[model samples]
Target: MPPLRPELQAAHDEMDETGQDYAFAVCPTWQGDAWEVNTKEVNIYSALSGTFKSHAEATAAGTAWLLGV
Candidate 1:
């Protein structure tokens, strides 16, 4: 979705190579066409408080963050 940020993509790729169990949580942002890992309903406190261009991007980035990759 919107081509995941390079770092997140790299992290995801690395996780794939490392055979790590990683999953992402994605939810819509207050604004349409955007998604985020952190939201008012879910208190995910970390550096991944980024507004992604789409749900897929947000989910991938959140997975990378959760894996600390």
Candidate 2:
């Protein structure tokens, strides 16, 4: 993975800390020598959407979207 800019990293980190109501779904997949940041809304790990506000939020959203509700 490439290095993220300091500002970008700060924004993301801030979002993470206070963004508990935010969705952050990350599916780590090993393709060969690197891990791919798979889709957050859909994929094998599509179990995350909007559940916990963070990962929970994502999961809830995923389930809901999957159910078409």
User: Judged by TM-score, which candidate is best?
Assistant: 1
Per-residue lDDT of candidate 1, residues 1-69 (tens digit):
398665445444544554434434455554556766641113222335668887778877876666664
Number of backbone collisions per candidate: 0, 15
lDDT of 2 by residue, 1-69 (tens): 897545344434544554344323332222222222212221122222222324344445544554553
The C-alpha lDDT values of all candidates are: 0.54, 0.36
Give Cα distance to truth, residue 47, candidate 2, Å: 22
Model 2 spans with C-alpha error above 4 angstroms: 23-69
Q: Which TM-score value belongs to model 2?
A: 0.30
> What ranges in model 1 sit over 4 Å off?
1-24, 39-47
Residue 41 of candidate 2: its Cα lDDT?
Answer: 29
All models, RMSD in angstroms:
11.0, 11.6
